[model samples]
Target: MRNFKAFGHVIIALFIISLSAWCHGQVELDKAPMEKAEKDALFSTIQGFVGNWWNGSDLYPDPCGWTPIEGVSCDLFDGFWYVTVLNIGPIYENSLSCAKNLEFRPHLFELKHLKTLSLFKCFRSQRRHQVTIPNANWENLAGSLRSLEFRSNTGLIGKIPSSFGVLKKLQSLVLLENGLTGEIPPEIGNLKKLNRLVIAENYLSGHIPDIFTALGDLLILDLSRNSLSGSLPLTLGCLTSLLKLDVSNNHLEGNLLKEFAYLKNLTLLDLGNNRFSGGLTLSIQEMHSLEEMVLSNNAIGGDIRILKWENLHNLVSLDLSNMGLNGEIPESIIQLKRLRFLRLSDNNLTGNLSPKLSTLPSLNALYVSGNNLAGELKFSMEFYGKMGTRFGAWNNPNLCCPLGAIATSNVPFGVKPCQQQIKLVESNTNGSDVNKTFYSIASLCHAPNHFWWTFPFIMILFLNSYIIGL
Candidate 1:
């Protein structure tokens, strides 16, 4: 009876030990597959980047643990290697693609860990008597890409594909200096993580997208140098994070939107070379951080009252050129203590040249040319004596004396004598100076000749009288 009980106990103990061992083995087995899966996924992503269609050259068949291409970086998380960045710009631009039909690699979409991808200066190889197309597959880009830049691709064309919205993780998208055309896709607003959106220097047309207001996190929005028409969208003020906004060089027109006052964080704003009209009278009090402001080449017309510069204490560069501004350049401009560059050219401004501009210690470059500005242009001690070659104001038709006459103005400053003749052409062509000079010379010559002829006759008459007296 004792032996049988002992045997049963031994059998039970062996069975329990076997079960524990099996459970441990199973856990070990499960971890190996999980780790393998992660490694495979990462390797696959790296292979995709290497085999990208844009990289027509077989330069990098395997970038992982090899002589990785320049601008390309990899990161190893866990036991897997993944491409964190693929700056294929240098490779694509350096290698010439002679392929008749260039194609963008769809394999790049497999890079699940891609964080940044920039394609700059990717030019196609020159072909003689053959028409070659560009290799840009915007749709095949990895959705995991956080930052994508395709700037200065001189040969790039075609409309922006709507599939761009699939990049949910995208934070920045720059497509500047391309030949892209067609209307902007409203689906661009789908990038909730987007902070900077640049599509400048393209042939894009149509109205400004109202959906852009959904990009609440946007900081820099540049759609300049496009054919976009219509008024500025008032909804653009919703981007509170906006630091720089450039919609210049477009066909956009209208007055400065009242909603622009809400852009308190804006530092650089450019509305130049547009058809924007109407008076600019929004309270700029909240724009304390504003540094550079350009409203040049617009049709904005008014009496040209300048607000207090004390509020714009941080202003560095201010350009109000070609706005049909008439009236004196306000004395308040000198109060902008931090002003470095000021341009008020091509306006109908009439004012006495300000000596106060020379007193500003921070004044570097000032351009008030092509205006009806009159009065003596005085060269400040700081301008001629200290900061030489930094002052420039030309083509002010009414500004006479020193500036108009280059010979007298530059000579006093110890400027080198010009080897060429200095001719001052008066702006008023109807002046009678030429006629006055002709009449004066003719009158002076007539009097001298008449006196000489009459003097001979008088001498002869006196001789005859003396003979009669004799």
Candidate 2:
């Protein structure tokens, strides 16, 4: 019942977000006249990409006043309307789908007041036709553009423009899941005010430029799922204000650096599925603010007890699975009261399944499978009831689950239940039955014929004894 309520709340939140976006992109009005030159530039740019069939001016008495382009948003400045945000591609139901012969026009960069421009799935057909983004002249909008994004355009092949570095005012730049090849241009570091730079799921290869630390205000820097190789720049520790840093699923190789402790505000750090080797540094554990830390699938063999995990009081999700981590599971790990997910599977971890694990109130998913863990699990029935199959404890031959009084509704998978032991009673080895021997001796005294003879013998013996005495 609690889970259902939580799920329903999530659904409501998502609906609210969708409605907000729809409201922001739909019907917006400012009864001011738009500049003729900027309007022409906007019309030509829209016609070139969305294919001319949808007449812009004919849609309403004033497009900016009544019904505007589905994705384009405008703002009033000096009593004149100007395009501030334009989002192309099939994002909304009425959003203009890319024309079969879509093309970029020079007028796109002429919107002097434009602050945002995003293209989503405009070049989706990878095999049919491909297009490269403009390699130059991005400087025209450098003064006003604050955000730029290109998302999920598979046929968009080419190198990221080096000219983009001139956009000093740009606060966010996202290039997600495209076929853009080549290395990330170093000029991207020149954006001093950059807050977020997400360029993942591409064919990009090369070492991440050391210029990353230049963006002092960088909040999120994700470069996951690419072909990037070579050692990560040590200077990355200089981004002290960085919050989320994900370089997973790349070929980066290096030792975990102690300089990582400089990131006093980092919340999420994922370096999984890389070629990182050597010891897992304790410096990262010093980042007490880290909520999620994923370092799985690297050859970074290390003892799990190197750092006191209790220091990371804000830890929520911790994954150290599939690495060759050794030593016993540290008891101090149970100190993280807010820990919800803990995965230590496929490692060389040893020792007993501590009963204190059940004491963590927020822990829901705990996977410690494929380790050298031993002894009977001592968690309460309520713990097993809530966790169920989420408590993964498989492939440890020496480990067993408690039974008898405990129930199995939420038994941890892939481990055997403990067997009940019984003591055997000893049998008499002298080969005589006690009951039969006692009954045989008693019958001699009780039988009728035997009693008569016994009385005569007794009387004769008494007379003989009396005569001798007299």
Candidate 3:
């Protein structure tokens, strides 16, 4: 009986040990496996762009587990770890920095699951080491990428890659502040899912592709600071959901299109510093959702009364400076209670300003300089003080400050006080003696201590003396 009890105890101890070992094996099996192909591709990509000195195996062995690369993230797909994000720039502290001779490796596109790839301020302008974006293989990332950005890379020169259109899943495509040249390719019209397309501050030229109509879901489309020309496409109206559209500082021309009114949701419409000519379009009155409208530095000539200024009730900033505008500033503009910055300078405007402008709840900067405005500014002392130099009513030869305004009001810059007209008497005598008498009489009248009561008496006496001598 004692031997049987001992045997049972031994059997129980063995069973407990076996169960513990099995649980340990299960834990090991649950860990996600890193594929050898993915690891090799990732290492080669980093080596190609960040320089060959980086050895991922020696520095970060388990890239998805115990050790991780900065600016790199991963996801598990079908029990294997895959890289889903790779950022090459100094955006974060201790982030991977691009080498001076950065080159795109084939392995980069091999990152099958990459959803976001950003390179910011990495390629400083070095002509000898200039590199263009990969001309092919972008289709590999088209299946999974959601965002791609290349910002401020001056050395990354060349025309924009047309293969970028293959990124069917891309939502945001930003290539701002690069040295890219050549016309924007029309192939980008294929990105029907793209919402934010910003290609500003590049040397891109040619007409804004009318193909933009296909991007119905686009929200922000900024092509500003490019050398693009041609009329703004009427097709832009198709982007019904667009909120901001900036194409300023281009060589575009033509009359303001009626189609612009169709952008009912657009909050900002900046077409400034272009060559667009013609008077204000009748359709502009319907852009009630516009919060800021900058049409300055164009040749848009018309009076303020052409359109009912009261229609833009949501306007906060309105810049129409240097656009050859003439005529009176209508009182209807004061209906814009939200207006903060109003610029109507450097034009041929002729009129008296409305004191109601000061009453605007948010009026901060008011510029009416370089016009033909006349009459005294009647803004409140507080208004003048608060605005100070922000009120730029200068270069108007006929405009003047209110009486006694200089003492209290922060008089609008470059304005003069209204002066009383002084009439001078003409002498009839024609000899040198007559000239001498006139000079003496004028000097007496101008004397600082002269009495106003004696001025006429002195002038008459001098005239009579001159006649007697003649």
Candidate 4:
């Protein structure tokens, strides 16, 4: 009876082990195969490429099975594998060239499950092909496509299609460094879900559309290095969620509107190299979240003292170079504890060097050249010497170095050493009056005469006094 009971226990353990192995094998076989329609679409798109590996053989018989295609990702949907992302370019480590004579294949749009598509340096091979992006067909993927990017396609030209507004599901759209021309379509505002829109380094013209105000969810809006003109629309302030706004290197003109201050979430604001002409707006002080504010190479002129620098505690870089700003460098600027770059060069500002500037722990670059600043620089010699050429205080004729101060070779190029002036006294007496005259001249040397006219008048007064004494 005991032997029969032990034999039954051993058989039960064997059965449990076999059941576990069989269940594991079943799970492996259950992985879905790539859908036939999607696989055919991918095959047709890369068929013209010379050395493509998507040849649909037993080795890569299944793109989502044991074998995987580079830069293509798939996911299981309705018990079948579907291509969800396509990154076609030389993005792989060993990949070198893109398709040489390739054209935009209509089969690419057949991937109904595609959610993301990125093509980098793939369309512009030798500048021979004049590829134009298809506009109306893009709406076909609007149900699933969330991100689309086309970068560095030199041959791409023509106006952006107004049909792009139909892609309501798109969350990001980037088309940078292309040969695209014409105006930005106002229909772009229809994409309410868009979080980022970058179309920089193109030849796009025309004024920015007021329809952009509808994109209240936009976080980054970059349209720099284009031919865009006209004043900024007041409707832009409606995008209160904006973090970075760059419209630099354009032909935009007119005064900066106070409505910009309403963007409380702004971190960076760059409007450099534009044709804007006006006083620096005081409304800018309301941007407490600002980190970098660049307005260089414009005609913005105003007193520096009007800026509320103390409120901008998180400010890191403030560039206003060649903006024609005037007035003294306010001491309140020292309150910006996080300031790293301070460029105010090529302006008409006049003030004594603020000694507090050197004490800021984060200061790295200081440019104040081509100004009317006067008086001795009171910062430590060691600090000034360490800055090298980054410290620009040249071109101020009235500004002079302290007496007997030794400057390094790296000191500002146009700065000159302070010269000590001596008053000459004339007396009628012969040898006896010589000692008294020398004493009178020596006293005038210690007198303060920073102004050019005061030194000559003091010399004449000393001469008259010495003659009377003799």
- Cα RMSD for candidates in order: 15.4, 17.4, 9.3, 6.9
Model 1 lDDT tens row, 144-210: 6889887776566767877677777789999888767888888898888899999999899999888
- TM-scores for every candidate against the unseen true structure: 0.69, 0.83, 0.83, 0.84
Query: Each prediction's Cα lDDT score?
Result: 0.68, 0.85, 0.85, 0.80
Query: Number of clashing pairs, model 1?
Result: 0
Higher-TM-score candidate of 3 and 4: 4
Better of 2 and 4 by TM-score: 4
Highest lDDT model number: 3
Stretches off by above 4 angstroms in model 1 are: 1-62, 91-101, 123-143, 379-381, 385-390, 402-470
- State the TM-score for model 3: 0.83
Task: Tell me the lDDT of model 3 at 224.
Answer: 98
By lDDT, rank the candidates, best first: 3, 2, 4, 1
| lDDT for 459 (candidate 1) | 54
In terms of TM-score, which candidate is strongest?
4
Give the per-residue lDDT digits (tens) of candidate 2, residues 1-470: 99999999999999999999877655443456788898889989988888888667555645566778888888888777889989999889988888867888999989888899999999887887788999777888999999999999999999998999999999999999999999999999999999999999999999999896688899999999999999888788888899999999999998988889888899999999999988878898779899999999999998989988998999999999998999998899899999999999999999998989888989999999999999888887788788877889899888877653223346676776665453322223464332311111212111334544575686577567545444
Segments in model 3 whose C-alpha atoms lie over 4 Å from true places: 1-31, 57-61, 421-470
How does model 2 score by TM-score?
0.83
Evaluate residue 443 in candidate 1 and report its C-alpha lDDT on the 0 to 100 scale.
19
Model 4: runs farther than 4 Å from truth?
1-31, 48-59, 125-127, 422-470
Give the local distance difference test score of model 4.
0.80
lDDT of 3 by residue, 63-110 (tens): 776668888889989878899998889989988788888789999999
